[model samples]
Target: MTGAKELDRFLAELTTERRLSPHTVSAYRRDVGTLLEFCAREDIESLDQLAVHHVRRFAAESHFRGLSPRSIARRLSAVRTFLAALVEQGRLTANVAVHVQAPKPSRRLPATLDADQVASLLEIKADDDLAIRDRAMLELFYSCGLRLAELIGVNVADVDAADRTVRVTGKGAKSRVVPVGRLALEAISRWLRVRATLVKGDEQAMFISRRGKRLAPRTVQARLNHWARVQGSPTRVHPHMLRHSFATHILESSGDLRAVQEMLGHSSLSTTQIYTHLDFQHLAHSYDEAHPRARRSRRRRQKTK
Candidate 1:
């Protein structure tokens, strides 16, 4: 089979069988396309002909072409997946790309808003229909730590006010029920009251446009930023920032790694550990309060004073 045909079949399987998200599939397509280009340049007609040296050269060339370590890593991963598929189908003897290592991606901590900033951001008055809707959206976002896609995909039935919980479908289409804070629940209740006025049809979406369609991801982002400006925010507020704040604040206060992981729907504890990094002042306070040596040192300083 032609390499192109092989990629098409793999992508189709990824879509239907694996149920990978569109963004993830698109990325795989792009990264694999780059590999094909490299293979063409190397006079390779089939991925079955690929060797370890060829993959090494491809990685080196990608790095020389100004691809960042993280990007190169992702591309390598895509190539590995494609080759592995080929091997599974008996197109190749082994997956050569597996031996090639990608550089470790730098771990940049996610940005988060402090409690005061979050309060200021969420203090939108429900004076109008759109305001009520936006208020509900913002409240749910921060309250639940929902991904923008997850928030956009919320249905009318997903939010259970009686139970004070929301059923969120996260990455990999994994669904989890997370608690809804009182403020978020109340805001949603208010929005539900006036929601019918803007809805045009039997839209089951929890958040809808004036035309009564499910709210688009772009619209959610624009609305969030628009409210941020109106609220006189210092920085541009995105949906993920609210999620970051939710996780950070929750971790800081509760100090429960496993709990935060479950609430965030993170499949790994390592992903949740990023929130363990507290502000320097918070760290200092913790040290002073919890460390026996620090307490003795403080007592000595106090005696000297």
Candidate 2:
């Protein structure tokens, strides 16, 4: 089969067999399209004809085309998975993409709001329906360390007020129960009371728009930025920042990586361990500013002389 036809079959398997998210599948489609393009250019017509050198050249070409290291790595990963599937199906003798490597991408630390900053951001007044709804959304985000998709997917039935926990469906459709903070529960309670005033036709979403439908992701983002500005925050706020802040704050206090991992619905401990680095970075910053022997403090003192 042609590479294009093979890609279609692979994508179908990703959707049906693997049950990957639409967003994830779409990314695979885009990434594989680049590979097909490379094949057409090289006159390589079949998956079995692909060689390691071709895959390496594909990565080099992608980099030269101005793709970042992360993007190139993701594309290479997609190619590897696609070719491996063909190998499993006996359509190819081997997965040629397996031996290729992309440039290593530098990992940047996730930006987070400090405790005081988070407090200021969440201190929004509930003067109106929208304000009440936004306040609840913000509280629930920071309270549970939920991903944006998980937060948006929440329904009224998912929250257990008596248990003080929320049932969230996270990545790969995995479900987990996480504790809700008392303050977040209070905010949600207040929002639910006013929710009836705005809800239209039997919407089940925990957070709804003014028209009573499930809140769109863009709308949620816009509302968060609005609250940030209204709260006089210096840094622009986003949903993920709240999640990072929640993880950081919890780790700072408890130092329980496993607990934070469960709450954040991360499938791997390493994914959750990034917060440990954030905690250490915070401590390092404080030390640099306060310690008499700190290099930065010492430099400042010497400059004063």
Candidate 3:
């Protein structure tokens, strides 16, 4: 089958039959679409004409263009899955990209702010209606360890203040209830008091924009960036950073990986274990500062000698 037509068919199936989210379908389209472009550049006419060498070349080209290993792996997966679908349909003889391997992604620890840094970041006073909403948004993000999409998807009724918990729809449209911190509950209550002012029409969203509609992710990001600069934070603060901070802080204090995984809505314990490395980093730093035999002491001794 021709690259363009075949890919279009597969993406339509992904959207219609599989019922994948628009974001996921778009990702699959991009990855496979890039491979089709690669095939065209190399003068390979159709999906059947493509070879394993072409797939490897595409990966090499992706690396040359500065794509990360993880990104390349995803792209490779997209290509492999697409070919598998074609094989089932009898358009291709076999999945040529099946044996192709993308480089293993390295485990990089997520950046997290300390408790003091978080306190400083969340020090925004509720000056106006918008400010009140922003404060609540920031609080809920840190309090719940929510993803950007999850935070925006929340509705007013989703928060149960009396119960001190919030029901959020996370990835895959899966819903979970997470506990709300005292500060988040307080901030949310303050926002609710002033929320009626912003709602000119019937908007059921938890967070509203100046137009009285649901707040966009970009606006949330822009506001958070402004606050991070104003607070004199060394790192560029983003929503995920708040989540990482929440997870790391909770793990450090509670030392409960399973509980954290549940709170994070992570499907696997392995995904949650990355925080253990971040925890170890703090321990290593503390040891260097406190232990006499640490490299910190060695540096002091060398300087004195």
lDDT of each: 0.90, 0.91, 0.91
Model 3, stretches more than 4 Å misplaced?
1-100, 301-305
Native-vs-model 2 lDDT?
Answer: 0.91
Residue-level lDDT of model 1, residues 111-210, one tens digit each, is 7888999999999988989999999999999999999999998998999888999999999999999999999999999999888787776888999998
TM-score of each: 0.66, 0.70, 0.71
Give the per-residue lDDT digits (tens) of candidate 3, residues 1-305: 24899889999999999999999999998999899888878889888888989888999899899999989999999999999999999999989999988877788888889999999989996787777899999999999999999999899999999999999998888899999999999999999878878775778999998788998999999999988988888889988999999999999899999999999999999999999999989888889888878977779898999
Give one digit per residue, the lDDT tens place, for model 2 in 52-139: 8999999999999899998999999998998889889988998888878899887788999999999999999989999999899999
Q: How close to the true structure is residue 71 of candidate 3, measured as C-alpha lDDT?
A: 94
What lDDT is reached at residue 232 by model 1? 90
Candidate 2 residue pairs in clash (backbone atoms < 3 Å):
none
Worst 10 residues of 1 by lDDT: 277-286
Model 1 residue-pair collision total: 0
Superpose all Cα atoms of candidate 3 onto the true structure and report the RMSD in Å to 1 decimal: 6.7
